[model samples]
Target: MDPSEVEFLGEKQLVSIVPNFSFGIIHLISGSVGPFRAGLPVKVPIWLAISLKQQQKCRIIAQEWMDIEKLNDSIEAEKRSKLFTKMPSNHFMDEAQMLLMVAPDDIPDADNIRTAVKDIWDLRMSKLRSSVIGFVKNAGTYAKLDHLTAMEINSIRSLLPDALDIMLHMEHGGKPTVLQSLNTTM
Candidate 1:
């Protein structure tokens, strides 16, 4: 899936919001949100929270994982791990991007949080790239990618599958089908 699609999924994750207006439970196909009260925080989907924030009807509460200290810890852990480490949220990157972009004023340490998240992302991506290069060079039949987030997997979707296909063809004593296809075209 593309980044936007991943973000769409991420938006479904619940976030805290304190609405200025009271409202009854919002019945949605996915699930139901609470009967909102003015000035009292309630949990709602990120999309709805963002919408309300944009409309000046509510304040968005940042997720716990959005904290700079926690994020920095995660970054250091990721740097130490050889394999992909578990993320605080399945959609951490997208969630951070959306919330930070929409309600920077609402979340404390927004600038530093953004920087920390970027650092974690960059570190993970660097590891992923190195793994991919090693996998390709070693002609690996398959590789375990535990704890990879959807966005991370999608980043390599276009390249890895095709490379694996070519490698599989070559490994089975057949000429690379990709090269054969190109030769035929020429």
Candidate 2:
């Protein structure tokens, strides 16, 4: 699966809404949603919220952690913590991007939200890059690392095959293919 898809597997889709009219409970396999009423906020899934919004039945209320500052802080905290820290939602950034596009009024700091997501992604990518370098340097002596986050593993997965190939070639006394190509045509 795509790294982002894997990352968002545990996404929480809860959203708050103010419906335009009274309604009965929405039955689902997971659970029931709501007996929606106009002018009163009721928590529902993003899918339902979007449907209501599109139909002009409700206005969306964004989550508390939807702010840019909060997201940046969360990213920093995750970096500092030795263990994984739970984010507000697994797919917050992706979900927020869609929400902002479809309902910009619901999110107050739309610009900052975009910036925050980009910053967090960049920070994680930098960390991933460093970790991969460290992993490569420690290859022969490598044992198990029990602390890597799912993001880190996902970031490194694509590079692993090539790295293993290089290690195997070196162990069998072959120079790196790239070095050999330095003197070759095409």
Candidate 3:
């Protein structure tokens, strides 16, 4: 059969077909969410279906690599070290198990998984910034803004604009008071 004449099923779960081997081609497609089972009839070309499946797999692998690279660049090594110490290997294993606890019959959606990952990434970034600011403020012993060095003052100033921007973007008022409080406390 010519490759171009093949048809495939792109379902997330195992695809069921009568007389499975009767098809000219069969391909297993894996994505971030789950795997898909595809089959081509004798009349369809096998090569075309296989090529499409391979393309899909390549795209998924590329996306995963990009995500991992982004995560590695964004997270600080010190923070990661602290996280690893707090969570421990057993905790990571438990979390991994929980993540993969879905039933065999249930196939997760790729788009949904991508969206979830994006949301979690955003949340973590926000938390990281907040914690860093908190740590700096807590560690400084300066009693007044005048007592702070130029670099320290600049750092605090930089954080204030971003914090205010976030508050404004969220439509939360009282940004001035928050800034004043942070200035006096730090």
Q: In terms of lDDT, which candidate is strongest?
A: 1
Q: What tens-digit string does per-residue lDDT give for candidate 2 at 1-186?
A: 586565354233787877879988989887898888778899987776777789888888877787767888977886796444565665655666656766788678878887777676666667657656776787753535454445555667788657866787888799557757876855
Model 1 alpha-carbon drift over 4 Å, by segment: 173-186
1 against 2, candidate with superior TM-score: 1
Model 2 misses residue 92 by how many Å? Answer: 3.1
On TM-score, the candidate that comes out on top is 1
Which rank order by lDDT, best down to worst? 1, 2, 3
Ranking by TM-score: 1, 2, 3
Measured on C-alpha atoms, candidate 1 has an lDDT of: 0.90
TM-score of each: 0.91, 0.67, 0.23
> In model 2, which regions exceed 4 Å deviation?
3-12, 75-86, 140-157, 161-186
Cα error, candidate 1, residue 158 (Å): 1.0
Per-residue lDDT for 70-113 in model 3, tens only? 33443444244432122111122212222223221122343444
RMSD per prediction, one decimal?
A: 2.7, 6.3, 17.8
Clashes of 3: 2
lDDT values for all models = 0.90, 0.70, 0.33
